[model samples]
Target: MKFLGALDDVSLGRTQRCNRRLTDPNRLQAIRDTGLMDTPREEAFDRLAHLAAELLHVPLTIISLVDANKQFFKADFGLPSPFSETRELPIDASLCRYTLEGESIISSNALADPFLKFHPSTGPWGIVAIIVLPLINPEGHVLGTFCCIEPKVREWTAQELKVMRELTASIMTEINLRNQITKLKTEQNLRDTFVAALTHDLRTPLTASKLSLQLLGRRHPDMPSVQTSVARVNQSLDRAERMIQNLLDASQIQAGKHVALKLSECDLHAITVQTLEELTAVYTDRFVLKAEGTFQLMADPIGLRRIVENLASNAAKYGAPGTPIEVVLGRSGAQVTLQVKNQGNPILGEDLKNIFEPFHRSRSATESAEKGWGLGLPLVRGFAEAHGGRASVTSSAEEGTCFTITLPLDARARAQTRLELLTSDRVAPASDVSVSTRE
Candidate 1:
């Protein structure tokens, strides 16, 4: 935290010995060896210049990468041109020569630096004060100079200088990190594409095997035991297909490649009732729908069904055998709320927040359930939030637990409703068609 004028006497004294070498040719050559001058190399330097100008509150900044003959602007902010030719000046005229000689930040009055005193733009551009620091890559190459220029003689605060240097370091690190991350993502995408293709190729054989098993089960009616085994094989094939589907969905979400929702106004009551009926056949007397209002909300029907089914499946799998898994839906003001309540021992306090995160499960549930991969809740939350709704939970040891989701039934919902009504009119058979009761 050295302030303005604290380094003035030293800097002014240093300025008097202006002919001293601040940086050496060997070091400059090492920086040039980075091959930073050829490929989209300007972005990193320009980013550094912009950041330096912003943070230092200077009128101009340039990330100048210098070589034996010329200085190329890697990045320049508030400067007239991208570069300045070294051929136009004497050997003593390069600002970066001072940077190389000092091997540290060089902040001085341009007028005082006898080296820059002959520069034609120095006075006209009002470049009285300037600070420059080297951009050193991780491999110890001084690739460029991040320098800021001011119009008038201003005291350079130590705090400001420290902040500028720290920013320069961060910019270099970020650029390196971005390059690494981009490469990793590209490699990962290739691997994922290969895995997906392999899965698809393997699925054709699995389907064929499944059909052969079904044919064996049908052709050998006399052997009941053999038929049962074939049926089991069929079930295994179905399970594998389902797993593949889940994997694809997860990959799509990760890669941001999911198809956008074709949203529509869905009858909340119809959705709940239909989902409950489907779950009851699967769970056998475990599902219940407790309605408080006849409400229509805006949502993607397939997505909403998936969310409800996952909730009901969790309740039936973990709750006390005879306890009802309740599906509750209602509308209040501009929001529609849905809750699935089950009389199961509440999850631990610490585990509640983490339950919705991918690949997380409760200790209690893990001990009880033999089959779960801990992806259900995360998928449910993702679907709900994607529809502009939120999923939450409330639990108490004595009262069991309820997971609720809320969605807005505002103008967006109404627009979706109209679109659904129009599509329904066009697609449904006359006998099966009916007008929507949306208000």
Candidate 2:
């Protein structure tokens, strides 16, 4: 074995040039994409590093990735107490940088080699020999290095280098497989969330429609309220259809698709008034509408109506029984604010934060007589945002609960921004109603 001088012996200009060449932007990005840096030491990787040390007859081995600023050890074997506790080292001090520059670097005599002798590991740690093999991905990017270190100078043989290269390939395969599994699990979670929301929300309206039809069947053909029963059945069917549409829109949003809107000059006041009137017909007079200032905006009438309907319905179901639900529509500056206030048990702090998330129902809500799938608030937020606006809620013991939506006078311009913010993790407040449609 021939000894080489330390890495620090290299001239400043040459070292800077080498550093620049090693930090390829695309190569660095590929390293990040592997999702391997700073990960917990896995037994699979540990076994490979152990095998390298054993086969090469060396005291230390490391499976490391050279990040932009640091060389991170994914697995390490045969290191002293304080060094074993270390997870990373600065890039400039890393011998692995040589392997990352695109080939295996082997030095049997570090104290005599110019670059190797000056390296921190060689000088202070007394590492006399080292062999580093690049862990190259299928795309031909050098992600990191697998290396063996010796405290005493030793001869480097062909078989030892071959074994280390083979182990590097195995390490890369495991990393790629782990990343794929992580991605698949993420996608599966999204699908499960969508399914849960759909199944739960559909049940509410379906049960209402079924009960209405059963009541109509028991009534005589000459019954005076026969027409009223038919109306109630129609309302249930309509609600069910709306629920399906909202779910579809939510899916579209998740898929990075836009929520289609029919924009036109519409009377916000009329929409609120009509929505409240419909609720009165179904649930008696538990809702009150208070309008101040002009409530006209360029918006999708149906979307606006759905937003109000969901909020009002949520207030009725969750508010204190016999307490009035207030629907307030007012204008501030160029924005119109629609607030649904209900007096009941205030939402818990944690639950309030996640209320608008799809398929999320607070403990209080789930315990109530009226059960829901937890999509109402999410849909309300989706519709509100689709109109280039935002929906928020405030709840406390003294103030009860209030869900407020503020929309721009012209929503078309901000439509794209709204779509971008509707992520799966977001939760919003919602409303509900039953045949007595009264809470």
Error of 2 at 227 (Å): 4.7
Question: After superposition, which runs of candidate 2 have C-alpha atoms over 4 Å from their true positions?
Answer: 1-128, 131-229, 253-258, 416-439
- Tell me the tens digit of each residue's lDDT in model 2 across 291-385: 87897788888789888988998898888988999899889899999999999999987898999887789999999998787878887787777
Error of 1 at 104 (Å): 1.9
How many clashes in each candidate? 7, 26
Return model 2's CA RMSD, one decimal.
15.4
| Candidate 1 backbone overlaps, count | 7
Q: Highest TM-score: which candidate?
A: 1
Q: Tell me the TM-score of model 2.
A: 0.53
List TM-scores for all candidates, in order: 0.62, 0.53
